[model samples]
Target: MNAVGVDVGGTKIAAGVVSPEGEVLAAVRYPTPRSPDKLVETMVRAINEVGSGKDVAGVCLAVPGFVLAQKDTVVFSPNLPAIEGIPLKERVGPEVGFPLTIENDASAAAWGEFRFGSGSGVDDLVFLTLGTGIGGGVISHRALLRGAQGSGGELGHVTVHATGPRCACGNRGCLEALASGTAIGRRAREAAVENPGSALGRLAARRGLLGEDVTELAREGDGVALSVLEETGRWLGIGLAGFVNVFNPEVVAVGGGAMEAGDLILASARREIRLRARPPSRDLVEVKEATLGPESGVLGAAALARNTDGAYALGG
Candidate 1:
């Protein structure tokens, strides 16, 4: 059967009709509206646009922040604050004319990897996306491990350093505060100040540095930028080491915009895993880049959806 998956992000909304085989049959994208009413309208329009004239059995929305699966409500989304407190199912189900469900974006992405991407061959998997913030999910024994409130698998909030920087979540020393793309930019600015004559320093003097700028500078062989990525990677590795011990996942797939740095970030993470993670688990885990890239959320949500006439369950 085919289903529609909608990745409702802070910046844009991506909706697609996907086949049972994980192929996207039709897709649409639109800039996300901030207002509650416009947001719902755009979402309905996107779903109808892709689902029109198709044999789509259901629809699933992949949204950010803490999601209460049973209630189909977004409790809090730091990036998309407008989505918070919205009764998604009640607002969207009738308009869409299909069985609808919701899942955390990162968890949905992990399911996408489990079914079609990096974790396809593994029974246990860990997925992380390092963007402006870090988002994560865990799949254990072929099941998505959503906590009681359906807000589990929040790997990014785990503290890697007790006395480190403050996170956007107001926590101290969270992995997101150290290893996310935003962290990279923050570190890059500090590095620029320390290395005034380096390429990174020059760029910072000309304009503000973003995470992508750091990667580009590193690609151009700038030592300061390279160091910044190295620092971020080590912090990521510190976090990964803990996950390796706890989840013992066969595959840890890293994705999102920051992954454009490729091996530059992962190589250090692997090294730290070896240094800090325990023997058997660390030896077995393979940390790799997620193959599904940006499409993972949509693909995973589509896979999780069910026909209107059939039963639908959140998580596994």
Candidate 2:
């Protein structure tokens, strides 16, 4: 049987027809609409477009927010605010006309990695997504861990420092505030302003840039740019060390745009994870980049549907 997975992101909505074996058979993408109703319409169109000629078993949506399991309402979403507290099942159920499931985007990605990507074969694992902001998912004993309120595994919000930068969650020193791509970019821009002679400054001068651009320059041997990445990686490691102590997962799978910097970022993170994490957890957990890349969200949502019977189960 086939399943339809939709990745409802801040900028775009992507849907794909996924087979039981995790292969994407068909895919469609569209800009996400602003309003809740229009967003649902856009998602439905994408689902129908990709699933038109395929035999679909169910539909799964991977959204970024605190999902109320029993109610299937998106309680809060920082990126897509208009849909917060909206009845997702009621809005999309009839339009899709099939069993539906909803999952947090990070959790969906973790499921994808656990089933078919880098974390495959690992019973306990953590999946960290380094996008504009940080997001994470935890899998323990071959099952996804959704906490008491279906809001577990929010590693991004984990406090990394007592007196650090403020976060969108209205907290100080969150992992996301310190090490996310946006954070890295903000720091890079500040560095460019401070040191005009540095390679990062020159690059920023030629074109107003951010973390990705700095990473590209570093790949070409830019010292200042490399330093920015190293700093971000170090902060990332600091956060992972805390995660290691708490979850003790078998593997830490890093995904998203930041990992594109390759060793420029991973080398620093690996060094810190080894230095700070407890020996047993450090030895038990392996830090690796995600193999599924951008497709993880949709693929994992498909995996959720393929494994479950279309019911949204928080912990099964």
Candidate 3:
């Protein structure tokens, strides 16, 4: 069966019709509106545009923040406050003329990886997206591990440093606070200030640095920029170490914009996991880049979409 998946991000909304084999048959993109009503309207339009003339079984929305799956509502989304509290299924289902389900965006992406990407061959997987903020999801024994309230797999919010920076979620020392794209930018800016003679410093003097800028500088062999990424990677490794010990996943797939640094970041993360995680789990788990890139969200959501009877059309 084919299903429609909508990945709603703070900046853009991407919708796609995906086949059971994981091929995206049709796709559409739109700028996300900040207002609640406009957001709903845009989502409906995106779904219609992508699902038109397709044999779609159901539609699933992959949204950020903490989702209350039973209620089909996003209780909290820091990056996309406009989506918070909206009954997404109720708002989008009738207009799209399909059965709908809601899932945490990270969880959906993890499912996408599990079914078709890095985790395809594994029953146990851990997926993390290091974008503006970190998003995480877990698959254990071939099932998505959503906690009792459907808010589990929030790996980013776990405390990694007791006295680290503040997170957008109002927590301190969270993995998101120390290792996300936002965190990289913040660390880069501070590094630029400390090493005013470096390439990173030269760029920061002209314009504010973003995570991408840090990656670019690192690629040019700028020592300060490389150091920034190394530090971020170590923090990421610290967090991954904890997860490796706890979940013992066969694969830990890292995705999103920050991962553009690739091994520059992951090499250190691997080192930290080896140092801190238990021997068996650390030795067994493979930490690698997620292959689907930005498409993981929509693909995962589509894969997880369910029928009217709540059966997954394309099982995870």
Candidate 4:
């Protein structure tokens, strides 16, 4: 039977039904509700929307926060404050209409990549999502490590600048604060406002600009946009350098909507990683773009469900 995968983000919940061979059959999305109860209701609704009345072997949820899959709990979620420490299984099971599993959103994406995407068959790999906020998942020794506290690859929270902007996690200089899509947009907007006559500013002055817009501008060779992306890549490189030094992953797969920058974002990240990391480790690692695109989270969530302890439970 197919499994249902739901990727719950700060703003939306994207759900899909996936075949055992990794094909997405049906998909749906809904705005995330604010209240904890409403969140569960929304998820149940989303699951049924995509599940299409099939008896799903399991339904997996990829949540943005610290997920304790063993206990089926969301320890903390800065974006979804109401659900912090909420017992997910206890709250979401009754209405979900099927067995369920929960996992960290980034970890889910990493698992998806490892199973069928860029890092497939790789024993050691790293996955980073450069979307609303930077997130990460890692695989070492051919196993997913969620750490003792189940937050192993929260690489975005790693400090990149000691006195940089404050992050949502209440910390200063985190990678998420520095290199995330939001960060790039923030920098782009600032540039557009400060120098409206420049190429990047002209594009921004026409309408509101997003991180993707900046990438588009960079692709067109807009000077300001290129500069902003280069800076963004620098931070990514600095943060990833630390990972390379530590994990020595064979491949680093970058994903998320913002990663659409393609060569603009990745090329810079690769260059910076090579410059900052040590010889063999830096030379050995290959940073590549994830092929799964937006569906990665949902697919990985399905993997989490199908491979949970009963499936492939990866509790550290």
The number of residue pairs in model 3 that clash at the backbone is 0
Can you write out model 2's per-residue Cα lDDT over 96-186, one digit (the tens) per residue? 7667887898999899899889998889999999988898999999989998867788889989888999887778998999888888888
**Any runs in candidate 3 off by more than 4 Å, and if so which?**
none
lDDT of 4 by residue, 75-128 (tens): 877777866777888888777677787779899889888877999868999999
The Cα error of candidate 4 at residue 296, in Å, is: 0.5
lDDT (0-100) at residue 181 of candidate 4? Answer: 88
TM-score of 4: 0.92
lDDT of 1 at 108: 89
1-316 per-residue lDDT for model 1 (tens digits): 7889999998999999998888899999999999999999999999999999998788999998999978899988877889998999999999989899888998989999999899997899999999889999999999889999999998999999999999988889999999998899889999999998999999899998888899998999999999999888999999999999999999999999999999889989999999999989999999999999999999998888877666432223
Off by over 4 Å in 1: 309-316
Q: Please provide, for model 3 over 1-316, each residue's C-alpha lDDT reduced to its tens digit, 9 standing for 90 to 100.
A: 8999999998999999999999999999999999999999999999999888888889999999999988889898989999999888788888989888889999999999999999998989999999999999999999999999999999999999889899999989999999999999899989999999999999999988888899999999999999999999999999999999999999999999999999999999999998999989998999999999999999999999998778998874
TM-score of each: 0.96, 0.95, 0.98, 0.92
Candidate 2 least-lDDT 10 residues: 307-316
Model 2 vs. true fold: TM: 0.95
lDDT of 3: 0.93
Best by TM-score: 3
List the lowest-lDDT window of 10 residues for candidate 1: 307-316
Which prediction has more favorable TM-score, 1 or 3? 3
